[model samples]
Target: MDNYSVKKLSKLAGVSVRTLHLYDKMGLLKPSVRTEARYRLYGEKELLRLQQILFYRELDFPLKEIGAILDDPAFDIVQALEGHKKALLARRERINTLVGTIEKTLVTLKNNTMLQVEDLYEGISPEKVQAWRTEAMAKWGKETVLEAEENLRSFSKEEMDGLKTELNDNITARLTALMHTDPKGPEVQELIARRYQIILRLTGGQIKMEKLEYFRKLGELYVEDNRYTPVNGMPSMELALFIKEATDHYVSEQKK
Candidate 1:
């Protein structure tokens, strides 16, 4: 098989040699073979893998996640890339909404009209918007409705998706580990505790009773939502099963 040296490959691919070296070190790419002088040579297969890596990197996937995704036999690169394009387009729409909101804010300021938070978000999903409105009414009363609306307007779709992806990956990775071991077992509980800490840290260390309830809801969301399935693959599912057993054990022991 024909092979190109690292320098040659980098030049051909329009990427820096240093970038190629880093990918090699990260195990995201490997040479097809090494010459007698120990120089790296990459072939067609490596080039295709490099293309896959570049595509995922363009979508802002962390290098580590990219590696795991590329290594997965079940991972469909074309399908994933299509999904990423859809996500990017959705983000673009949110940016347009934000721009419109800013324009509205300016007009309100110029006209001396009182601008409320609700006016800031011109577009929000009907279901979530209604839920937020309901929650705001219940918690802060109608008087502070603008405050909740303002907070909702602070995040764009890209920002929200990024946050969700990070959290989902992190929780899935930890939960998958916890599921493998006994939940009643100290080690498993320790893992759960660590996850609890992660949740707290994500919430800026304000893990109050309501926030704990929120965490429970988040877990239920995983069941209600299939978003967890992709990150928590087979191994992760195995881990969840183990964790459930451990939790049962702990509960039964508590009754003793």
Candidate 2:
């Protein structure tokens, strides 16, 4: 097996030597060999581990949690890579949707034209969207509700449709597929954690993911009142319960 010095491996991995040292310090990545001068020497195994580290980092995983995950006894490199592919693909779709929204918003601004209400929310009824505005205005002051509507002006009809597709077809579909898995499992928790941020954005920060009880309450809203039924591609009680239980577990873990 080829062995590389710390500096050499750093250059190869596009990471700083100091970063490698920090990883070593955190017990996240350890070199396999030591030279006569007690210098760090990394092998192929280290290279693969570093690759995994970078992959999780790209997914916004914290370094400490990444270490815990990588060191888990049940960790499987092949499985992890497959999960990474799915997550990255989902993220790419969201990014593409946002970019399209931005482009459309620019065009609308330049033309000084506005999208029709029916087109703004393509799949859903315009009246329903208007009802949502009215309800939001009642719950949270009118200014906040108006500001949230103003933000939606940036999304084109197609981008609005893409957001719906991404949420239902991509995120929800994947979560439904994992419904058979343990809610407390890494895959389930990780997926739900990402979904939490999406929910905050969807609500225009009107619903904060700040408190544990509030966070779990949103999940409860899924099955109880079908409050999120409109946007979540719902009617699956099992999937809704899975999300509720999973988010509850995730919130518990976060507190720890």
Candidate 3:
């Protein structure tokens, strides 16, 4: 194993020697060996451990918790990294939502218009909203689910029914007809754009249709959700896969 002096390891790990010394005292990190003069030296394993420490710190994990996690006999580096990746992704998604909310709030401020709470969930029924709330609460706990959202107590049932009618009567029909068309073709892309607009309308500006990743993820949802994928699937999954393909192509083209 390659060994590094405390100073060299500190430089390589981008940590101060004092910090490394502190970690050693806390039993969070121990050097691989000691020199004849009692100087500290680290090995490759110590270097990797220091990296894990930094990663946890970046994610706001407390030093004590980070130390415990790294010292756990059951700890697996890959699993820890995967947890970090998931937490980061969730954080990014929250940031995007906040940014979108800020943009809408800015527009409301500029126009001197009030943003009604009901408008945040336009064209969605109380029943559906409640269903969503139930699912969220089950997964993330009631307080966590409700603390960040406006109380979704009521909504116009008629608006939700109208949107459902439009989806069943108009949108799905149009998508079905275009199933055989090239997803990248002008006609299909146009239809996809129209569908996006309709979603924006129904959402009352809550959904950021402008995000290419959002649309791409929605396409993935259609393929993964059995409600959308009714047939063989992929290019042959009929209207469901057609919408997925068309929306994906639409996003790709928009990037150019």
TM-scores of the candidates are 0.35, 0.37, 0.34
Ranking by TM-score: 2, 1, 3
lDDT of 1: 0.58
Backbone clashes in candidate 3 total: 0
Kindly report which residue pairs in candidate 2 clash with one another: none
Q: Rate the local accuracy (lDDT) of all candidates.
A: 0.58, 0.63, 0.59
List, residue by residue over 1-256, the lDDT tens digit for candidate 2.
Answer: 6478888999999999999999999899988977789899999999999998998888776798689778997867577667877978999999999999998778776434323434444456667767865765675567754554455554443444455567677766666666546533566455554555554444333444464345544544442453333546631222223344445566786789
- The sequence of per-residue lDDT tens digits that candidate 3 reaches over residues 158-212 is 4434544565566556666665455445664454445554444333334454653
Q: Model 1 over residues 188-247: C-alpha lDDT tens digits?
A: 344344454443432233455544444454444453453335433222112223233334
What TM-score would candidate 1 get against the native? 0.35
Q: What is the lDDT of residue 129 in candidate 3?
A: 59
Regions of model 1 farther than 4 Å from truth: 35-38, 59-62, 76-86, 105-256
Global lDDT of model 2: 0.63
> How much is the lDDT of residue 149 in candidate 2?
47
- What is the descending lDDT order? 2, 3, 1
Choose 1 or 2, whichever is better by TM-score.
Answer: 2
**Which candidate leads in lDDT?**
2
